[model samples]
Target: MVRSTNSAVRQDAAPAVSERQQSRVAKRAAAAKPAVKSEPIELPQDIDSSTAFQLIAASIFRQVGANEGAVRSANPQGVHQMRIGLRRMRAAISVFAQLVDDPETTRLKQELRWLTGRLGPARDLHLLALRLRRARGAAPERQKRLQVVETMRNEALATAIAALATDRYRKLQTDVWAWIEAGDWLGGAARRQVPRRARDFADAVLAKRARKIARRARELEALDVEGRHQLRIAAKKLYYAMGFFESLYDGRKSRERMADYQRKVKELLDHLGALNDLAVQQQLTGSLTPVVRQSDGLAVIAPSRHERTKTERLLKSAGRAGRELADAKSFWD
Candidate 1:
C-alpha cells in the first residue's frame, strides 16, 4: 500500500509493450550497429553451492590478474577493461553470495573493496592522461599548451603506478586468490528448505536484494552522496541477482522493471564516479603545478570540469528515480 510520488501515473500506466516487441527493437538496433559477442555461458541445471561459487570466484580472480597487470604496465585501456571485469565479478558475488555462504566471503569482499580503492586514483589518472593524449594528437600546436598538463599527468600516473606496486596491494590480491582456493566456503552450515527448492531460493535471493535496494533508496532520498553511491552498489547487485536466476523468474514485465532499475543505478553511480575522478584529477593538478597555478592550465581541462557538474545533476535525477522504483509495491512483491 506504499504510495509512490507518481502514483497516478503508475496506476494508470499503459499496457506494457510485449517482451517480444522489446527483443525485436533490440535486434534491429544491434543489426544497425554490430556488437561484440562472447560465447554463451550455460548455467548448470543442478549445482552444488560450492561449485557454483567457485565458478564465479574463478572469473573474479582472472579479472584481478588482468587489472593488476594493467596497473603494472600503466596501460589505460587495460585498467579500464579490468575495472569492468571487476564490476562483473562483484555483481556475480552479490547474485550468488547465498550459494557461496562462507565466513570468508565477507572478508574477501572487503579485500576487493580495498583493491578498488587503491586502483581508483591510478585508473582516473590513466583515463585523463589518455583523453588528453588523444586530444593532443588532433592538433600538434596544442602541445605547447599541454606540456604542463603532460607533466601533471605523468606525476599522477607515476604515483598511481607506485601505489599499485606496493606490498599491501600485492597482499590484497593474494588474499583474494587464497579465498577463492580456500574450498571451505560453507563451513558445513546446513541449509533448511522451503517446499519449493529452486523457487524458494529465487524468492529469498530476490527478497534480500529488494530489502537492500529499499534501504539504499531511503539513504539516497536523504541526499547523502555517499549513501546514494552505496545504494547504487546495492542496486547493481540486485540487478545481477535477478539476471542470474533469469530462467527461474522469467516474467516479461518483471524483467523489464529490473532492467529499468539497473539503468537508473548506473546513472547514479556515474555521478559519484565523476566526482571521484575529479578528486584524483585535482590531486594530480596540485602536484604537477606546485609553483604557479596558471589560468590556461585549468582552462585546458575545463571540459572534464563541466563533466563533473553534469554528473552531479545525474546523481540527483537518479536519486529521484530510485525513490520511485523503491516505493513500487510490485518491485518488492
Candidate 2:
C-alpha cells in the first residue's frame, strides 16, 4: 500500500482544511524517486482521491504546530497530543501509501518514529513522577526519593528537547509537505486507472479493517501481554484510518454515527494505553530506583497487587469496546 490514500484531486473549492493541506506541498521536490504502489483504489468521477489525501494528512500534521509549545513547556498533555498527531500521520501515510511513495516518505516516517520515541520516554517518566509525588506521604526520606525520580525525569525531558531542536525534525516536516503537495501522483500509471469513489473505498477498506478488529476482540480475554499489545496497536491503526476517511461518508447522521464509533475506539485505546503505561512505570521504576530507600527503607510506590484488579477491569472495558466497533456498520455505507 503506497500509504493508503492513493488517488488524485482538483483544488476547486477552497476550504480552510484544503489550505492547510496545500501548505505541506513541498516546493523542493528535487529528491523524489520513480513510481511507487499506493492504496490504488479506483477513484469515482465525483470524488478526488488526491484532495482527500491532502485534507487527511493536513489535519493530522496541523496539530503538531499547536502541540510544540505544550511539549516545550514540559506539559504532559502537549507531549501526548504531539504523539497522537504523529501516530495519525503515520497511519495516514499507510492508508494512502500508493499515491505518495517516495524515499522521503520513508525517511519522514522514520523521523516521526525517532521523534516520538524521544517524547514517549519523557512523557512516561513525567507521568510516573507526578503519580509518585501525589501519593500521601509526609516522611522526609520519601520526599528525597521523589526528588531523585524528578531529577531522572528532567534528564529525560532534556534529551527530548534536543531531539526536537535537531535539523532532522525540520527536514521531516518539509519532506512531508513535499510529499503531500507533489503532483507526481497525478502523472502516475495510477492516474490512468478509474479509481473507486472515495466513499466506496472507505466502505471497503473500513469493513475489512473492522473484521480484523473483531477477530482480535474474540480472543482478547485469552491474550497475554504481547497479544494484548498487538491488539491495542491494531485498534489504533484502524482508528486513524477511519478518521481520515470519515469525510467520505455523506449525511450528518452518517458522520455522527462514525463519530460515535470513533469515540468507542478511542475509549478502548485509552484503556489499553493506561494499562501499558502502568506496565512501563512498574518496570521502569523497579529498575531505576531502589525498592527500598537505602537511607530510610522507604519503599517505591509502584502499582500494587490491588492495581491488578484495576488493570483487569480496564481490559474488560477495552474488549467490550472493541467488540462494539467490530459489530458496527461501515459509516460509508
Candidate 3:
C-alpha cells in the first residue's frame, strides 16, 4: 500500500476543529467563493516522463479545485469545466500508466471515477434542460415536461454537491496530491525508467493511440453503437494526449503539423459528440416517462422525426473526420 507523505505530515498538526466541523466549514467556503479560471499548462522542453506526469496531474487537480465553488453554486460552465478537468486527469493517468503503476494509482483512479460518476448525471441533465429551454414555442405539455427535467437536473446537481462536500472527496484530493508528489511509483524499481525523455515517451503513446483510432476508423461503417462509442473515447484520449505534449513539439513545421492533427481530431470528436448527445437526449427524455405519463398520458418523450436523418448525417461526417484523422501526419513523428 502506498502512503501519502502529506497525510503523515498532517498527522503531527494539532487539530483546531473536529473533522466534521471542518468539512462543513470547507463546504460553506467553497459555496460562497467565486470560481477561479484554469490556467494553461505549459511543459518544459527538457522534462522527464515522471516530472511531466507530475506537472500534468497537478495542473488538472488544481483546475478541478478551482471550479469547485462554481459547481457548488450550480454554475453550468463550472460543472462543464470541472468535468473536463476530471477527464483530462484520467487521460493523463492512462497515458502515464506504465510509469505510475502502483496500488495507490489504482485506488486514486477509482476515487476519481466515483467523483466523475457523481457529476455525470448532473451535467447530462443540465445540458438536456438547457436544450429544452431553448425550444421556442413549445407546447404547454412540453413546457411542463421541461419543468420536470429542470427539477431532475437540480436534484442531480444537489447530489453532486453533496458528494463534493464529503470527507471522501477531501481525502481523495489529499491522497492524489500526495501521490503526485511522492508516490511509491517514484521509489520502486520502475523508477529506473522514469527519467526517460518525455518526448520519446509521448511519441510512443501518441503512435499507439493513433493506431487504435485508425483501426477503428477502417471499420467505422461496420461499428455498432457501443463500438463507435469506444472509438469516440479512444479519439478523445488521443486528443487529450496530443494537447498534453503540444508544447514539446514547438518548431514552426511541428506547430503546423500539430495544429492540423488537432483540427482533425477535434472535428472527429465534434461529430461523434453530437451523435452521442442525440442518443443521450433520447435516454434522458425517456427517463421522464413516469412523470410524463402521469401528467400528460404520453408514452415517452418522443424524438423529432428528423432525428434519424440527423444521426445519419452525423455518422457520415464522423466517418469523413475519422478518415482525415487516420491520414494526417503525426506531429510527434
TM-score, cand. 1:
0.60
Q: Assess candidate 2 and give its TM-score to the true structure.
A: 0.76
Comparing 2 and 3 on TM-score, the stronger one: 3
Q: lDDT value for candidate 2?
A: 0.64
Local accuracy by lDDT, each model: 0.53, 0.64, 0.78
Candidate number with greatest TM-score: 3
* lDDT tens per residue, model 3, 1-333: 111212221222223334454355345535555555556778899988888988988888999998888788766567778888899989998988889888989999999987887777767777788888887687887788887776566556666677788999999989999999989888772555643888889989998889888988766767888888888888899988887888899799989999998999999999989988878777777767876788778666467768889999999988888888888887776
lDDT of 1 by residue, 3-44 (tens): 121222222222343455434433432333221211222336
Q: Which stretches of candidate 3 lie over 4 Å from their true place?
A: 1-38, 189-195
If scored against the real structure, what TM-score would every candidate get? 0.60, 0.76, 0.87
Which residue pairs collide in model 3, if any?
none
State the lDDT of candidate 2 residue by residue for 1-333, as single tens digits: 111100100111111223222222111112222211122222233676666777677667777655765565555566777878888888877766766676667777888887777776656666777877876766686577667566555555555545667898878777777777774554562654434465655676677777887888766767787887888887888887876665566578887888888887888788778778777767656645553466456766666676788888888987787677667665666
What is the descending lDDT order? 3, 2, 1
